[model samples]
Target: MVDILEKLTIVVKRGKADKNSPYPPDLKGQDGADELTAEALKMGFTPDEVLQKALVKGMHLIGEDFSAGRAFVPEMLMAAKAMKAAMKHIEPFFKSGSVKQKGTVIMGTVQGDLHDIGKNLVAMMIEGAGWKVVDLGSDTSFEKFLAALEEYPDAIVGMSALLTTTMVNMKGITEKIKEVSPKTIVMVGGAPLSQDFCTQIGADFYSPDPQGATEYLDALVKSA
Candidate 1:
């Protein structure tokens, strides 16, 4: 059982989607995250166990590697793909309340920024870490974010912008969210954002990578 769980973690970390996936070269032909996750379920492992012990653990390692510059965007994307493949089996359990999500994250690329790659990466990583992600996609306006916040009152909001000009819009959106919900946590990211800019905009946090955001959300959930 432990061996199966470990294999699941390795496949996820190495970005192997299934038996047919040839990614990472060395792990070729091995049963990947998709197959191992299903097998773990058939072996009587609860969805929560498979998630926490396998998927989350694997993502954490990848996150650490990313933070340390040991991994790049391509590797992260592949891992996310593998994680997504595995998540297909666990989502039903989430719907049935057998697997509890840590929290909800409302994410998007700020208005005027049509880039989605970074936002999507963050969304996938956060979702893989057990939080429910509400992705609003690119070129999202403050009104759309506000509407989403209204729907998921307790959700944390994340804004991204790849352009320096578009990044300015985050200040307006952050201010508006704070105006309506004083307690809401707002996180900002993307190539043009800095910790100073985040603080200047009154946003709660700024991370250069998806893992930092995921860790912050995890800490928030535990404390809640």
Candidate 2:
């Protein structure tokens, strides 16, 4: 049902969680991402189809809107909520190996950066893009990151820093990861980050927004 799939996308993009969610006045009380995703599954739609076609498609639109400044944190947060609600029904498939993820992505905020909004956004976007995201939360240290890498050898590392002071710690963390696992790719982001700074810190990529990070990871997975 192309029509149902399209509605799922709209529900996600509009941040509808379920019939009870009232944030978006226009579609209040309408069946949101939760019900629609479950309905799609009941209709025999494959999990991969729901993820790639419905979820990722909707996230891409939100990402583009964020990149163009058409959407702010509130909008993106709502989108992430919708994505999570949809994911609740499909995560079991991933765990059961019925739906394999593109890759694992280990993410966290660097030490001294207690903020989690940026890190959470990146993690949500990455997960919505079909990666198995291992979120380490805020104020994470190098040892913790290295431990996560050891657990998921093929995972790419994403580090976030909201404060300029804490951004320097990203360099130390990257170096440690490279020293232990030279092949690991480290991506850095947050308000104060720049591409040149990312290079200086020996990180592989730097994205100002979640959409950019998603695109970078998608390209990397495709190439790999």
lDDT of 2: 0.91
Q: Tell me the tens digit of each residue's lDDT in model 2 across 15-86.
A: 888889997899977999999999999999999999989999998888889899998888888988999999
* Cα displacement (Å) at residue 105, model 1: 0.2
lDDT of 1 by residue, 84-118 (tens): 99999999999899899998999999999899999
TM-score of 2: 0.98
lDDT comparing candidate 1 with the true structure: 0.93
